[model samples]
Target: MTWNFMCLILSLFLSQFVHSLNNNTTDSLDTCLQDFAFRTLIRHRPHTGNLYNAMLPANLSGMSVSIVRLRSRRLWNRGANFCNFHIPSRTIPVPHVKRLALVYHDFGNWSSHYYTVPGYSMITPVIGFKVFDASNMMSRSVKKLSLNTMGKPIVIRFSNSTLSDGMVSKARCAIFSSNGTLHLGEITLANVCFSQDQGHFSIVVPLKRKRGQWKLWAIGIVLGIGGFILIGYVVIASVKVLKAKKIQVMEKQADEDLVLDTIWVGRSKMPSATVTRTQPTLEDGGLP
Candidate 1:
């Protein structure tokens, strides 16, 4: 038992390590993508608001990144909308920077490598955006920022998302936030999700039940109930049979315990008891 308990502890630790390792890998990937996005912004400072695609190395081929710069006031009045992300008006960056760069990323075919919602399968590629301070592009230091949506949510739309059989009814919005937390919410529209902050988001459906499994389950339940009822009836019948046999044994014992005279009835012998309560008294009792 001690050995088994120790093994369980070890397994738990390993599972936690694996979970953290995935998050760590995604974190590193995000750092790399941010660097690439910042470099793209620096290379194209002339066009402040145009979405410029960042050229990634062959190692990250399927993934795409883009960046767009906007002033703080413009973001408050006309929120930036590009790369499948919609930031509505009245949104502003936290810590209040004069300008911010919105970096967009489409994880493309590699969406499952860095993130997964357990018991769910991804139906669309993971797409996300991050905000960073771009107020002083000349300076080397850059910091990340957060968005306050003011109760109005940011929309992430999955275009041309095709839900296969058995997934249409179960599909839901999965948001893996940047802060190491996950959230699941209902799918708004056909294939869309809303978030109040920056995060990687996707559409996921619960794992499907195996074919014909429910039939087996139903059969097992029916058999269990039937077996229980059969056992109950057998027990009741056995008890009644035993009671009848006991009553016969008691009658036999009573017949054996008493001595009786036998009389011939019409065609059967009947047990009859005959006894004198008092004998003839002697002269000592004379006349009573």
Candidate 2:
């Protein structure tokens, strides 16, 4: 009876461990699928009005999957838009993704929807379906594509096939702000080659200047001007002071010279009168 009880207890522990492992696996797989969906949406920006059906293998139909539109205001574009999907979930309007994608999945479909995330400088939106089937499991892994915009504008240029074939094809261009908030739509390109081999595509996204940056520039200019004025005033005042000192010294020297000339003239008259009296005494010699 003792041996039987020990065996039963061991079996129960093993069973619990196995059950926990299965649950962990399922959770990890679900997280991977969500990441795959996000990456797919960002890479091939599809029109927002369309639907995307995930293509899964025959065995994974039981997985529950759904795409939820998460919105929040944060540092990106100063809380004017919500484009970042990787922000922490603790913030208000919590992010739908709880963690970064540790695994990569690829969807075979190429079409997707694009909606503009607000507060960007251009018409930039997180591209994904408004709704998806979360009721079933994903059979195959989704491919991971590069979708990074570190507060930088993405430039997408579309060229016609004829232009690539070395023919004169008319192409149109548009500009968006770095945050993808505003869209400067449908600009006509001049001198564009429509050749089939010479496709011309260029995206000129304008950089956004922050309000604080403008304020800093204005402050620097004002300080620079003020400093220059102050330095000029100091120099001018010094020059005037030096000139006044020089003039004062010159006037003092001139007065001293005038006083010396008057004393020399008075001494010369006294010497002449003394010489006349001595000559008369010598000529008389009366006592001799």
Clashing residue pair totals per candidate (backbone < 3 A) = 0, 43
Candidate 1, position 184, lDDT = 85
Error of 2 at 215 (Å): 12
Q: What lDDT does model 2 reach?
A: 0.33
User: lDDT of each prediction vs. the true structure?
Assistant: 0.82, 0.33
| Residue 276 CA displacement from its true place in model 2, Å | 20
TM for every model, in the order presented, reads 0.66, 0.24
Clashes of 1: 0
Residue range 11-127, candidate 1, lDDT tens digits = 344334544555655665676677777777777764767888986655566889988989989999999899989999999899999989999999888777667899998989999
Clashing pairs in 1: none
Q: Stretches of candidate 1 above 4 Å error?
A: 1-20, 164-169, 213-288
